[model samples]
Target: GYILSYNGGNIVNAKTGEKLFAQFLPDEVIPILYRYAKEKNHALLGYAGNEIITEMPDDQYVKEESRINKMNIRKVENLFEALEPHPTKLLMTGDPADMLKAENELSEILGDRMDIFRSAPFFLELVPKGIDKAKSLLRLLSKINLTPADMIAFGDGYNDLSMLKLAGMGVAMQNAAPEVRAEADYITLSNEEDGIAAALEHFCKRIFKSKRLKFRMWFKYGLKAQKLLAQGI
Candidate 1:
C-alpha cells in the first residue's frame, strides 16, 4: 500500500480502505504555514489519471473560509453517505470540516468495523520533525540508486532548503530566502520573471551550446513554478 500523509480532511470507512492515514495538524496552523506561499499565489498539482490537475486561481484562505467554502459540508456528507455502502479503497487528506463530516457519517454507517489511525505530523516546514522532504527525498534517491552528490536541485522555500544544502548543485530563485540564496550554487530569477528561462539560457550558452537542444530547462522550471504558484488553490 502507498504511504499516506494527511494535510486535512477525514476517512469515511477505514474498514473499506486498507488504512486510514491522518496527520494531526491543527486547523489553525495550516494557514500560518502557508502564509508566504499564499502571498506568492502558488498552485498545487493533483494527479487525475495520467493528467495533472492544478488548482485554479490559488490563494490562501482562513480556516473558517476553508470550512464554509472549500469543505462544503453538505456536499461532503452526501458523498460519504453515498460511498459508505461500497468497498472502495480511497485515500484522502484535507481540512477538519471535511474530516469530521466523514468521521461522523462513516461511524454511523460502518460503526466498529472502521479502523482509523492518526499519523504523526510530518512537518515539511520548520526543521526537526519526525519525517519530511529530506527523508522522503533520500528514500527516493535510494530507490533510484543515486546519492546527494549526484543531484542537482532547484527550489524556493523553507522545506526545500535542506535538500538544496545537500545537493551537489543547488539552484535558488531570486525570490527565495536569503539563506537559500547563500547556499545555492547559482541564483535564478523569480518564478514569475522568467527566472528559469534566464538560468537555462545561461546553461545552454555555456554547457550545451553545440547540442542544439532548443527547449530550455530554466524556462521550463521557472514557468512551472509560476504556474504552480498561481494555481495553488
Candidate 2:
C-alpha cells in the first residue's frame, strides 16, 4: 500500500538506515513543526496550522492556467484519457459546501478514472490559501485538455480532503479523519491491508501480476549461479 518514489531512498542515512529528512509538507512549515514536535516528544509530529485550504480549483471560471509560460503544466484531466465523465454534465444547485458535495457525487457516476496521491497531514497544511490539489490537478488538466470531471483521488488525511473532494471519484480510506470522510464519495479498505492496490484493481480495471511472478522468472537463473559457485567454474 506504500507508494515509493525515486526520491524516497535518496534521503536515508547510510549507516543507521534512519531517515534524515523524510516527511511530506512544504519546506517552510517543516522546520517549525519539527522543532515543536521535538520539544513535545510527540510520535505524530506535524504542523497544525491556522489556515488550511480544502477547496477545489476555480478552473471553470479561469481560462489561463498559469502566467509563467516556461512551466509545463497540464490539468489532471488532460494527462490521462478515460478520466472524464460522459456527456460532461454541468449542474448548478446550492451554497459553496453543498455545491462541492454535489460535484463530487456527480463525478463518481459520470467519470471512470481515479488516481491516488498519498501524503501526510503536514503536506495538506502546506497548501497555501486558495490553492489546493484540485487546482494543481486542474493545471495538469488544462495542459492536457481534460476536465475536473475526469479524475479521481483517494486519501485518508486532512491533506487528502481537498484532493478527494476535487477528484472525480474521491474515496476515503476506512481509517480517515471524520472531516476527511465527510468529504469523500466512497469509503474503501484500510491503508494497512493493501487498500490502494485493491481499489486500483477494482475501479481502474487493471490486470495485476502477482509479486511471485518476478521470483519465478529469476529463480532458475539464481539456481544456476549457485551451482556455478559450488563448482568454482
Candidate 3:
C-alpha cells in the first residue's frame, strides 16, 4: 500500500510523489564529495527530480528533463555551501581517469561510511553511511508486519545486490553481472525475453507442484543403497 522510491536516495513514501522522506547524505560526507568535485573541476548536481522532471515517457530513462531545457544550474565557489538544504541525491561528473583519486580522498575522510558508485563513465553517485536500498526495505517491511524472507526480489545491477540478497528469493536476470548471478537464489531469462514474468510463473508453478515420493537412503545402509541410487535403483 506504499510507493517505494529510490530517487530520493533511500526508500521514500508519499502519495503525491513530490514529497521526499527526508533521507539525505550524511553531513560530513557531503563536504568531502563537494571538496573533491571542486578540486577536480567537476560539475555537481543535486537530484531534486520533482523540481526538474515531470513525466517519464519511456520505461528506462528520465526524458522529461530534456523538455524543460536548462536546469537550475548553480555555481558554488565554496563547494560545500550548495548542499546546505540537503537534496535527495548527489551526482558528480568529472574526467573518468580521476575517479580513483577522488574516491580515495573521500575514503580517507570517512572510510567506508559512504558509497560512491560509478553509475556512468563520468558520473558518480554518492550515498551516505547506513543508507542503502536493503536497509530502507527492512524499515518498510517492519511497518507492514513482514520480513525480508517474505519477499522475492528481482534485479540486474550492482546496487540491486543488497536488496536481492536480503530477499527470501533473489532472482537475477540472465543479463546481470557475473557476481550478481552468483549471489542469486535463481537466475531467470534476460529482460528482452520478459524475464520477470517468466520467473514469477516458474515460481508459482514450483510452489503449487505436488510432492513426489522418493526413496530415502539411510546411513545404516551405507555404500550399498548409495550405490544403488547412483545406478538409478
Q: In terms of lDDT, which candidate is strongest?
A: 3
Model 3 Cα shift for residue 138 (angstroms):
1.1
| 1-233 per-residue lDDT for model 2 (tens digits) | 12211112113444575543232323343344334323432221111111111112233211111221122223332211212222111112223353344335433532233111223321111222233455555555665577767876887766567678777889888888788888988788887777777787777543335546667767978899889999998
| Candidates 1 and 3 compared by TM-score, better number | 3
Residue-level error in angstroms, candidate 3, position 14: 5.7
Report the lDDT tens digits of candidate 1 across residue range 1-233.
23322221222233465433232333332333234223433322222222222232232322222332243222221222233222212222334454344435433543343323211111111111233445555665665588988876776655467667877878898988677788889999996787877887887687666453445665677789999999993
Q: Give the TM-scores of the predictions, in the order they appear.
A: 0.40, 0.37, 0.63
- Comparing candidate 1 with candidate 2, which one achieves the higher lDDT? 1
TM-score of 2: 0.37
The parts of candidate 2 lying over 4 Å away from their true place are: 1-127, 204-233
lDDT tens readout by residue for model 3, 19-105? 334476667667666666666666665544443321112311223222323454433334355344665567665566665566666
Q: What local lDDT score does residue 20 receive in model 2, on the 0 to 100 scale? A: 36
Clashes of 1: 16
lDDT over C-alpha atoms for residue 125 of model 2:
19
Please report the TM-score between candidate 1 and the true structure. Answer: 0.40
